[model samples]
Target: MSDNTKAYLHIYCAKNIIVDEQKFSELEHIKGDDLEDVIKVSTDKHIVTANYDLPSNSVFNSRIKAKDISISCPLLEAGKHYVISIYEVTPEVAATEESTFMDYVHAEEIEKGYSICLYRKK
Candidate 1:
């Protein structure tokens, strides 16, 4: 498959969570069409941003390891928590295009010491 066809996976965590191979492997099975739909709907309704969306025509999939959420997101921090989400986006949508403070327009508490916040960065 072409690069576009290959899924882009990202990892983010909330405050010093030990992430190891086992954690990553545990998350490997979490990606699929069903999870993608949940992410799409949740992001579309909650996140308020014009540039925030998953790449359309490209597979939108993700998984979580430890307290980190892994998806095709940019500007992810290793010790910060984020809610896994998806949104239809153009294939050419550069990750940098949405990397701005204003683009981070939402935040919500998900788990103790873990909160979901909009992020756009490398």
Candidate 2:
């Protein structure tokens, strides 16, 4: 991939990931110890992080997974769809009539159960 090409790294099997500031700031939790930590956003890396204090109803989701709740829909390409394994993320849920979060995600197929994914934007 060219240096100019943007990469979405989302690994979930590592520690102290070396991601950019936006990625680190996009962490699902850090709101409260009583909140549920779930995968919610896409980043340059696949190494997702979350605590076990998230709500039981909210799960990090994407359109590719359930189509019910997923912000990653914009990440999907037109004809170059690759199978990546998406881990289950249960984050804090919104109270309004419309939830402000994507709390469910499923990978069509993952890299040996790994959480790293790379797809060109279409």
Candidate 3:
């Protein structure tokens, strides 16, 4: 069995590119008009399992500790751009690109594992 740990996964949708701290801080308090800027889609606890042998073609395969980190979030939808933050405190806006969702994968044997995928918006 793969070793797994409980972690908080914060999902954010970027409306526009965050260049400065002021614009980045807006992600914290989402207002009416600001809603179009950045939206905190989902925040939840999940079991993150390490995949030692990840597919070579996978985009996240090169990322440290990202290759096999699997979690289930039904709220995720296909074809939508998202930023997946895996940290206790507020995640820095800079990790947005590196932490982007790859895409969804079906895991039938892994308990509680759902379609896992991550992708960036063009």
Candidate 4:
């Protein structure tokens, strides 16, 4: 894909394993100490999409919006501890694994018209 290509990803992060449990519900269950810690970090739509080519060592700050709540992402860095989940919205190819994050986790088609792929940073 070209550099201008924009891919839609439902980005999420948490202080604990609650986010992982939701992403990989079919896998072996993961237990977390507190369910309240599983706060939705941020969605791709909230951030600036123009800065897509972030350097490997670059660090930036952003906000996380969950429902009526909005807060900082806390020293957000590129290619750090993050799990990216991609939803196939169309049959046409828009982005690839190389242009995005790393570590292919799992992918599944929940129904005939819906599909999702998960990737974890290495």
Candidate 5:
């Protein structure tokens, strides 16, 4: 009944900041409690920041379509733990945020040369 691919959904768990991306798929069915907090949108802007647990705070840029986000920063180096967040920021959220490098390969656009979803590891 929808043409869009659901990428992100879970505001309650994300609110207390307990939801972990590594277990993102587990949150898919998370519901019945404070789930209404989830941000519903035709479009939204978000950022993916990766922390390699190093003194240097270097991050790579990536984007997500709609209000849903799914990305794992692959900057893991030896002897380091990586942490990333998909922050739903305000005051700076712009229409251009949806226009990103990853948008081209969004799940819905897969047949149109955005076939990168297969390597996304779900």
Candidate 6:
């Protein structure tokens, strides 16, 4: 992977995440005792294919019409938000057929029934 190559980090487990500063600022005004706290997970180190669109009832989705939602994955929970990050991975990592995150996850799954990944982007 060249320095120009980039990778996308998708946190599948997070129920709520603020990807941008603008959106994160809004959390302060939300009134509720059960406000979700943002947990900064460390990056163990982390596709643009089809132009698929999300269903009309997709979560954290803008009411727009376009074919850019092709990368949608099944949300583990409804009405929850997950963070999507994009960054460059090391050349060694990017060269792998599997993502660095997946590589770590798969190894953990074999060693332990459950695994925890805390990856913070640099």
Best by lDDT: 3
TM-scores, in order shown?
0.22, 0.20, 0.19, 0.26, 0.19, 0.20
The C-alpha RMSD of each candidate to the native structure, in angstroms, is 16.8, 13.9, 17.0, 16.6, 16.5, 16.0
Q: For residues 31-91, could you state the per-residue lDDT of candidate 1 as single tens digits? A: 3333421111211122222112222232464533333332223433333323333323322
Residues 64-99, candidate 6: write the lDDT tens digits.
Answer: 432321122221222222333222333234334354
Better of 4 and 5 by TM-score: 4
- The C-alpha stretches of model 5 lying farther than 4 A from their native spots are 1-67, 87-122
Local distance difference test, each candidate: 0.30, 0.28, 0.32, 0.31, 0.27, 0.28
Candidate 1 clashing pairs, residues 3+ apart or interchain: 13-80, 15-79, 54-87, 54-89, 75-121
Once fitted onto the true fold, the runs of candidate 2 whose alpha carbons sit more than 4 angstroms away are 1-10, 18-20, 23-26, 30-37, 42-122
Q: State the local distance difference test value for candidate 3.
A: 0.32
In model 5, the Cα lDDT at residue 81 comes to 17
* Candidate maximizing TM-score: 4
What TM value does model 6 have? 0.20
Candidate 6 clashes between residue pairs 3 or more apart in a chain or in different chains: 42-118, 42-119, 42-120, 43-119, 43-120, 52-70
Per-residue error for 61 in candidate 1, Å, reads: 38
Candidate 5 per-residue lDDT over residues 39-107, each given as its tens digit: 211223333212211122225534322233333222222222112223333213322245322221122
Error of 5 at 7 (Å): 24
lDDT of 2 by residue, 1-122 (tens): 11223333333223332222334444442222223222234323333322212123325642222211112323432233222223332222111113233222332222232222222323
Give residue 33's error in model 5 in angstroms.
24
How high is the lDDT of residue 83 in model 5? 22
In the range 1-122, model 3's lDDT, one tens digit per residue, is 11122211223322232322223444343333324333333333223333322223347666432233444433433334333323222122222325233432222222122223332343
Q: Write the per-residue lDDT of candidate 4 for residues 9-102, one digit (tens) a residue.
A: 2343322222322333332333333321212333332221110111122256444322211221222333233333324432122223454446
